[model samples]
Target: MAPYASDDSTTGGEVDEQRSGRRKAARYVVPVTVMGVAAATIGLVPALADSGDPDLPKITAQQLIEKIATSDVQQLSGTVKISTDLGLPDLGGLESSLMSGAAGRGEGGSSADPTAKLTELASGTHTLRVAADGPDKQKLSLLENAAEYSLVHNGKDVWGYDSKSNEVFHGTASESPKHEKGKEQQPPATPKDFAEEALKAADDTTSVTVDGTAQVAGRDAYKLLIKPKQSGTTVGAITVAVDSETGMPLKFTLTPASGGAAVVDAGFTQVSFAKPAASTFDFTPPKGAKVTEEKDAGKGAEKGFGKGFHKGFDKGEARKHAPKSEEGLGKGLGGMKTIGEGWNSIATFDTGGEGVPSGKGGGDLGGFVDSLGDKVTGKFGSGTVFSTRLVNALITDDGKVYVGMVTKDALVKAADAGK
Candidate 1:
């Protein structure tokens, strides 16, 4: 049930600086984190059990919110299962297309098909084993069929291993080199992390309630229900199951506005609050495996699973084909900005033609993006609007990208307003 560090251990000037930094970081990171997780889990659907609601003392919404906000559990290990059903087309076709392109290039590196790896994650139920001893030591392992992919954070070093590819990625990052633990390192993909992000949206636009108690991971828990009061947002509500004894979040679920079932549901099947073994964070790449090293791994280590793989594995290969405009755009996420606030907030960015395949060797990815959504034309100009059960993304012909959990009409309006 324990995940992510929200330490309020500073005083005076340091406190003010840390708070300011957190606000700025959240503004940029949370939106992309939400959108990226949703996009990746297009077909994932978790299988959660119903053991009946447990009887417990009543608690208010604000109380539950505060409980989660101030949870200080430092160490734990757990198994998380994630399932999402976004009602989008299967990405298997695109995976094949990208893999074919990779093979054609005669690339046999350890991280050959980064896009393909993400597509594979989209289709199935994903089980992750996560352990965290403290802020500086943590581990996340994606349990695949007979194979495991792991990322370990031990002291100043981060290690990633792909068992199937037999490839290892190592990066060195110092914990708050300048600020003395003032910065919050990016947490691994987990329900607790997602719950904390969702909690930030519980402002004037959201209605939060404590909807009784339930048993999660064999522990008695309280259910925190958060609903958006505004329209145009695809998110109907987010349910977070928090442990009763400890304030830690055990599960997080997001349902669509036009709801049938939850679009994304992630929860622990097994959890232990005890500190994980010291050796858990210690890792060594296999003898015959190819190894890639990054001197500054702080940024790359933040991305979860497949994205982290691409950032580390294809770091060299990508630079060759990357456009100069993209090189500049990469500095600040291509002028990315949010147009609104809370549930209906829209994130707009300049793609610099990153999504469109340009060269002769490029495969059917252009066709793939073109196939997903209808061609839309408006005051903002012509573009393609791609949608899933919970998100809508508009890619303009002029290389602008607009994404939100709102309807296509709302997204277009936002785009027009921006233009």
Candidate 2:
């Protein structure tokens, strides 16, 4: 039977079997290749999309103000760690030391000075913690003494407490009835209003940008970068983590703009919307603690008129030691531009040197004028120029002679000084 014709039949069968095996292998390989490619493409798409949309929401001034007007209570609490730059005005070259003290305090350590305790508490989230940085880091040291401040708003009252000094400042609600004596009733401040005021008082000259997204307390957030319009301020750029869901602020970062120093990061680890304790708004002085009433140091008072106006200087000739450069004096006057119509031109004088004693430090010009009350009544000028003059007999830290000029002139000098 010719060996059952094995050559033709078996060879054809073998060829068919090999073709079937190849197809099976190809079926498995094709899907995996497609899946891998699809995953890679999907991953790359989000990055490309996010890159194209860099402009963050530009919150208008009016929007911010309105938010403040409507808010009732706002509270942010959390474990906070801060790294500050002493080079900035706020830190006052003591940022590192202050941070170290704060860390120690968080670990249940004690500091040598009361201010250190305040710093630790102020930077913390507890009732004792303080909110230090705003739009600019320059105001860090300025608030060092505020370690004991409490901002509380009840449904009908707003109260500010300075625990360090054992004083309570209260602002009555707008709807409250005035005393028969005709005292004007003050209205309580809402949380939204507080936030708005803080934002407004922040360094507006600079612009802020959102860098990207981040995670805070396991929630999505956006990182915002704030830059100063001018130099010499405590803050250069602040990276803030804003909650994605609520648009509320979570964390803050303070860093130098030129990239020379370490960055300071502070954040709220916990937050609650519940109304703060009623006692939070009450200010009762501690036993044996002296209570001092706070006066609204008028604009001139800020120039050095209050009781501690010359705390850093001596009594006889404090002006002899006042800051001389136009920039130094102008810093205090920068806010004059924002003052609404109520006053005329503002000026500063370097009362140091010559016949003036070095003990005569800068006095609060606002307070001095305010004491005169109606006698000094003048509507704030829209285009007021604050002038300052340095007594040539005195010299500044940099060996520069005493300098003085008005706000407008100081700005001009500051701009030209660099030239």
Candidate 3:
């Protein structure tokens, strides 16, 4: 009887201990099971990565481009910052002024800021073209027009058309200078022309790396880094964020090659890529505006020197003796027989003025004057003269031909000749 009781008590104690252990485990098991399910669901449905191949799928440049080319278009509007080597004067101020002026003019429903221009181009409606004085100036004017390329979806097969010059240029993905020149060399077939040209001329490209994920234009995007392959080739490496859903490039940054130093950056906002109307590529020359094919006249003329010479001549005795006439200033200057046919505006001169002595030596006058001619040629192809210089040639911007210079004395002589 004593043994039985002892055994029974021990069994009871063991049963109670087992029950307590099971209760403790039950307390944790429910929460643990829930957590396990949550983790498994996350693993199955992967969250977007920041910028890597695993997080972001690999894509070829051509594939990315095709997506943009074929996407449906709706209205797009946003702000963007473009970077280029062109020397624009106070771009921020210029943008402000343009905005105000456009508001006053009230031309279209368009906004005046360059950021607005990007949206306009992306909209794929009217041709968003820029009319620059010349190519070198055009390069710098990217910001002035808002760092955006006009979109053309019309059936006319124009991608990078220059309506101002009535021309088209095309390009390929191959990295070669032979194809990167301009509309004169490669008539643009589509927006891809601009990208291809830019990539071809890129000094060095880094190993492409895809970062994680982010939102751009309210869409998921993958960031990519393209560093310059060579050292000191560009300011730095450029990183671009492409939309994973639409495959359109969303944001791009250019870091300075010298580590953290950077000169400029550009971005696209409120972006969309879509097929445009059949008329988007259609353009007609303004009734009186002349449309001429662009010619490769080599690098544009240098600035500063030519304008400086003009300023110097203005201060010198030459100003006093310069033949003057009621006709335009160009006519008066053209009256000088020594002045040649291609002379445009004198860019610079060192006249003995104010503090300076008389007959101050002209510094590199030939180069200075020659640059003026080059500028004229660049604008209108080898022969267009500035209106000021046209007075001598008896030529007018309207294509009128004249002879003899319009000198102040010539006016008197003309009066006498008439008499």
Best by lDDT: 1
**What tens digits encode model 2's per-residue C-alpha lDDT throughout 344-385?**
111223323222112222145333322321221112211112
The C-alpha stretches of model 1 lying farther than 4 A from their native spots are 1-51, 93-109, 112-123, 175-187, 295-332, 354-364
Worst 10 residues of 1 by lDDT: 316-325
After the best TM-score superposition of candidate 1, give how far the Cα of residue 79 lies from its true spot, in angstroms. Answer: 0.8
Q: Each model's TM-score, in the order given?
A: 0.73, 0.37, 0.32
Predicted candidate 1 versus true structure: per-residue lDDT over 252-346, tens digit per residue: 88898897987778899999989899999888877988776653322223223323433322221221111111321243254767788777787
Q: Candidate 2: lDDT over CA atoms?
A: 0.34
What is the alpha-carbon lDDT of model 3 when measured against the actual structure? Answer: 0.33
The alpha-carbon deviation from the true structure for residue 115 of candidate 1, after best TM-score superposition, in angstroms, is 9.7
Which TM-score value belongs to model 3? 0.32
State each model's C-alpha RMSD to the native: 22.3, 17.2, 21.6
**Model 3, which residues run further than 4 Å from truth?**
1-81, 85-205, 229-234, 259-264, 293-419
2 versus 3: better TM-score goes to: 2
